[model samples]
Target chain A: MLIKKGAEANLYLKEWHGRKVILKHRIPKKYRLKIIDEQIRQYRTLHEPQLMHKAKQAGVPTPTIFMVDTANTTIIMEYIEGKQVKLILNELTKKERISLCKKIGRLIGKLHRNGIIHGDLTTSNMILTPTGKIFFLDFGLGEFSKELEAMGVDLHLMKRALQSTHFKFADECFKAVLNGYMETFGQETEKVLEKIREIERRGRYIAERKEKP
Target chain B: MEYCLGIESTADDFSVGIASFEGEILANIIDAFISETGGIHPREAAQHHSQVAGKVLAEAFKKAKIKPKEIKVVAFSQGPGLGPCLRTGATVARALASYLGVPLVGVNHCVAHIEIGKLITGAKDPVTLYVSGGNTIVSAFDAGRYRVFGETLDIAVGNCLDVFARTAGLRQREGMPFGAIIEKLAEKGSRFVPLPYSVKGMDLSFSGLLTAAIELLKREEYSLEDIAFSLQETVFAMLTEVTERALAHTEKKEVLLTGGVAANKRLQEMLRRIAEEHNARFCVVPKQYALDNGAMIAWTGVLAYKHGQTVPIERSFVKLRWRLDEVDVPWVKE
Candidate 1:
């Protein structure tokens, strides 16, 4: 199997039914007691697919699982032959990046409308294939929650990623993403955005204050 | 005999367990604890999982005196844990399970705790107090399934302990989990300032309780120990009260303590005493199985495997909201 190791899961390129697919295998750690790990794997193996289905309903692109080998803790999904949004973001001329950023933003907005929060929202997790479609991948750390704080963090994650990765034109890219996000989230976006500011303020306050000032 | 290896990495401790089709525990190993840098950084924890996960799995098999080929199933805690930590275990389990040509099972970390409680208690049917670093709840087996009766409205019990410890300038993510440290500090401390007791019907809120404690300590320069003492007292009492109510509502004669909080001896004592007072049986799993771990998954996997329930690789998904009630009981449903 052609395998690429991720920080958490091992990604393998596999062919099933004459079509290529990506297999995300959650490897087991021996450091922990046995019973605990079994429970976690069982829950997650099922959780990821449900998220994908939900995302699909929300108009996001995700690979369909061809097979789930729970005994192996592996999820085999349809593979997209495209560059990651991370790599593509670089290849995009400013206008393209802004355009793609708008699309990403809209996708995130759609996700929010469905009451789903993408736990880790880095550009690298997005894929832009030759078909020019945006496919959001990896829901290993995702959960279903309606909390505004959770939703704010989800947007904040993208903001941080854009700032850190595309500092050259972060403001523009962020604005584009925000516009797209507003397409669906509309008014709720304002609330989460405001909450995001508050969250940042709280974080900064905690960091600065030493001994009660 | 074919076996399924399970791993749990949703939080501070890492757990490994192997189960056979015969319902036997082949091996269960837990790496003590990893210190969090400056605190528990999600990325850092994920990085740690990437580094040692492979070796950890190898060691589990090595200790069990079993070969990877002998294993036919694998499972890991999927959620209700730290995203980074959960990813670490999830990635590892998926990879190894693939290599071994086995079915991968994604078990909810909380549900796994409860299942382990059921196994240890032999209660067959009982009310459950599932408390851990990531969750605090009163649950009961209903209609042949485990269902949530009451839970923390906000902030899990363990999160309260960790957040408080971090605020008090106490070492965060110490050698043991911060919960154990808080318990110990509570034992040594005396001053009990009035802390907020937020018990709304069956639901509880530790976040507010934690805020009150932090606010109190800030208002009156108090030692970390006293704050920890009061926080534990306020939160544990809140939990016990809800559990008692769950027991009464469900009318279950048995109560099992599961999850990381079950590891706390004082909490166990309180639960046992309450159960005894009601003339009900109280069962607590050994400390090893209390926290997020793999054995519970393996044990549950055996039941799933026996029922000839194999999730096709094509239809597999990780459930972020996987509720145990949705799953039919391992044997009875079939």
Candidate 2:
């Protein structure tokens, strides 16, 4: 059954060799030229699993890859039974939300330490299991980048996602996340935070100059 | 009926539009300053606007069949555009307002585009993707404001296309821009040359792609048709992907494509497909409204005036870097 139809891909719940798995098929965009569509789908399909494995190696929890079918531009990964963090964020107690955000921050720090940038670090991409373990999903936009600018952009995206989706608790949640990030990332935390400020300033229409009367 | 007269000289086009207070566009006359050699020279474009300002205003008045005294307000595109062009428009607007003894309204160029799109397409609270030579923004109404979900971090998508077309020695014919020429050639193109596809989260960087495309043209390894095809495919895909991301994030029920590049058929198809995938209504502003024009400014001004938004002569300074989110849109109740 098709569980979700995302922009770049479609997710289906299926049983592969008696194991519950998610069949992620990067759908071909008919509006795009054939060669370009094939190239993108093929590249991202092959790249996402590699990044997932790298994140796992860095002590971040990600779904285990069960199978990779390049020709079909699909990946069969272990199915995670949990609620997306986006759906449960507002329902959680204040203390629980803070702790969860801190853990999310630490996980992101681990990924950055291993030179992995979760390009789309939104709450919807995270799942909290019944066992209370948080698993990160969707590495399609992730990449291996050690540049501080890239790392800062990753965290900035996380901040923007929270502000847009979870605006009520965004400030408190982000503060806790930053605390956890500092605890894990250590020395580079300040620089990365500074870079985030710079990136925010770089955004178009973020007025910094004084308006002349 | 009360009417608003709006002047637009934000870029190469100098236009005047008259709109009734009831949200009806009466007349929109445009005089574009097309450079024969390169991209628009700001000072030259502004001079062209000043020279033709009177004629354009007269033509709009004649078309609308309204005397100058009948206009209740005068409005101009105030910023996020070329300084020279904005100043020329602002000057005309101020003079007209003072002469008619009516209130003056200054409009944000980007916000006008979105408001006009919504007015024409009947898209209520849609996620708008505004792309042009000057801007590439994906925004949606959130918490009483239009918040930008994604935008270009470097050169705009349209500028990237124009620069590449110029580098490839593409000729721009009457009514056909460099982007149109590229789109025409891309139809015959079969091969795809890989280029840098840079999308950092919701933000896009197109300067690298532009540089890479120019380099490919110089290399002569690929056919012009092939390069055009590759460029369009890559750039449009990136735009579509970001629009999709914003849609997923906001979960708005409608998707609106506006700005100059909104006229591209391929972009419309791509955005329509994404909207369908998300089960949202897709709307593209008509070609006349898609590009910068006085009609959008006039319509937005009408909205502002209705909400008692006006600027005094001293405070009517042009804002060259006005952001859409910074402007308060009182007419839109989300």
Candidate 3:
């Protein structure tokens, strides 16, 4: 059965070797030319699994890839049975939410340290297991980059997602996340944080230039 | 019936539009400043606007067959545009409102584009992809405002195309823009030259792609037709991807394409296909309404006026960098 429909792909729940697995199929977009669509889907399909494994090696918990069908642009991975962090964030107590956000931050720090940028870092792309472990999901937009700009953009996306989705406690959550990130990522965290501020200033500069009247 | 007069001088076009309080557009007159040599110079465009302001306003009144006294509200494009151009339009609007003793409504240019599209296409609620030479934004109504989901990080998509076309020795005709010309060339293109494709989450960057396409043209390794084709495919695909992402996020029932770039058939086709895939209705504003015009401002002004949103003459200053999301669209309900 199709569990979810995304912009670039669709997710299906199926039994693989008597174990439940998610078959992520990067469906061809009819809007794009056939050549372009195929190239993008094939590239992303091959790229995501490699990044997922690298992230796993970096000590971040992620779903194990069971099989890869590049011909069909599909990947069968371990199906995670847990609530999305987005859905459970508001329900958690203050202490629990802070701790959870810190864990998320540490995971992201590890990923960045390993030169893996989670392009989309929203809470919806994270899952909290019943045993109190957080697993990052959806590496479709991820990339391997050591550039400070890329890392900054990844964190900025996380900040924006939190502001839009969890507006009430965004400030507190982000602060805790940064604190945990600094602990794991070490001295480089300062530079990455500065780059985030620069990115933000750049965005505002486009809008605030008119204030010079 | 009450009427509103709108003045548009946000860019090269200095247009005047008269619309009824009931959403009927009576007359829309536009006088554009076309630079033969290069891109628009802000000061020159503003001078042209000031010189033609009287003639366009007079023509608008004649076409509408309504006297200036009939207008109950005066509105103008209070920007996200050229500073000098916005000042020219705002001055005219202020003078008219004060002379007629009518309320002045300042409309956001980006919001005007979306509102006009919705008004004409009859889209109740939509995720809008508004692309123009000056802007490329994907936005939707949420939490009392139109939230920008994605936009160009560097240069706009239309500006990128225009720059590439000019570099390829393409001339801008009276009716056909550089984009249309590029589209025509792309249809006959057979080869695909890979260019830089940058998409950071929801945002996009086209400067690298533009730079790469121009460099390829200089090298003469690929035919112009092929380069044009590749550029369109890559850029339009990127745009379609971001729009689709916004659609997936918002899950709106309709997708509305507006702004100057909405006239491109390739863009419309791509957007239509994506909307169909998502089971959402796709609507494109007609050519007359798609391009920057005074009608959009007038119609948006009416919407604002009815909701008791008006600006005082003293504080009717133009905003050259006004963001779409910064404006409060009280007229739209969830």
Candidate 4:
């Protein structure tokens, strides 16, 4: 077992007779009330992964579950050995980047069509397995929402991440992503996107004003 | 078993991860745009993600050593982030999953980071400080969600660092994003121009600090580095205060510092001091996990999987305005 220690949980790389799996165990604290801590741990242990599963059923990409151990606050399942999408993008050509982004946009549009909001959307949470596949992970914060405000924030976060990381070709890259999104969302999603932009602009303006005084 | 593979493109770079039960990181590919000689150009970022997202995912599966038949789920970042970038990641995850006879799960990137931290550190109830370009806040695991106890009413700490990094003429793409160069300059130039320090109970404000720094720069009132130094200090201090408060409020003993800005040694040190003072331990994922990577997503995927949670293919879609509070918690484990 390969144990990875976190602040609140203990993760173990559990392997069984030629089988490989990872186990995350949320350890208890000696300082807190057992009831409260257990409640939090229990809720998270069940709530998060279920959200991931629900997102999967909704057509968003996530991982499959195998076992849940609330007593030890551990989750055990398959372990994929691959690279992150961030690294994969680094290796792609410019033209390839555009084509791929458009496809991504359409996928996001589909998510909105299904009313699934991925609360925290950033590139860091994505994966690019070697065989031309994309996966979404971490639905601990996933939720169901018909409200555009939530969706607006979701898209806004993506734009912000792009601008921050792809400082050079952010605009073009975003355009392609938008292309993909529009493909599935239809033109009606434009208004929602526009509103998101306004919110983002407001945020940028606030930050911009602070930079100078 | 239903599997949900996660693809994150909500930013310049593209990333993908497969989350089974505990999450086996299949791919963590990243593509950065080297500006000829400028700072973050939004238009450019969008184009880049648009271009490379597909190849990245292809590579992700390859790295995982898995075939499409071996997978059962596809997860993509929905939103609560940049639209274009989010769309790029979301759209790709959506399309491929649709073709694979797999279910799609839309993930929140912010929560992904935190969940990864949780997966890596196992911090079940630790306070989370999500310091990033678009967000700056002190968060806590509460009521089945990571609640925002304190956040910037204006700009985010990472964004603040990025703007100064640009103005300071630091290397935009390659270096430590912006915090490193800016913070280093901040070290020598010690003339402190009192920046805005707003901490109204749990809420904080970073715009005021950025504004002060901008004014000083425009006025040429002091050396740029000095102003940068002050800003970093003031902003980091603001974050430390709020984090400390969250710890206190939640009575949580540990602090998990995730996000791009978490890479800053100075910020880490300052936060460590606060944690030490409070007798709370602090956990900051290594740079790979800290800045942004599929490992975090894959790691968080493990937790999500165990709950018997799965998103339907046709119903699955991207959310431009996803919020942490909106996700429903259903635990089959307990």
- Candidate number achieving the greatest DockQ relative to the actual structure: 3
* Alpha-carbon lDDT, every model: 0.72, 0.88, 0.89, 0.66
- Stretch of 10 with least lDDT, candidate 4 chain B: B325-334
**TM-score on alpha carbons, each prediction:** 0.59, 0.91, 0.95, 0.59
Model 4, A1-213: lDDT tens digits are: 655444345657777457787677766643322444466567668876776676667666666777887777778755656665555554678898887667666667877778777654545557655665556754444567778866776776566555433535667878888888888888778787776755544553233322332
Q: After superposition, how far is residue B70 of candidate 2 from its true place, in Å?
A: 1.6
RMSD over all Cα atoms, model 1: 20.8
Per-residue lDDT of candidate 3, residues B147-216 (tens digit)? 8878877788888999998988888867888878889999999898888778777888898899999999
Candidate 4 lDDT for residue B172: 56
Docking class of 1: incorrect
Docking class of 3: medium
lDDT of 4 at B120: 69
Ranking by DockQ: 3, 2, 4, 1
CA shift at A184, candidate 3, in angstroms? 2.7
**Stretches of candidate 4 exceeding 4 Å from the true structure:** A1-213, B1-4, B34-43, B331-334
Per-residue lDDT of candidate 1, residues B28-128 (tens digit): 77764566422456677677767777677777888889988988888777665566777778777777777878887767666677776677667667778
lDDT of 3 at B20: 97
How does the DockQ of candidate 2 come out?
0.42
Error of 4 at B178 (Å): 2.0
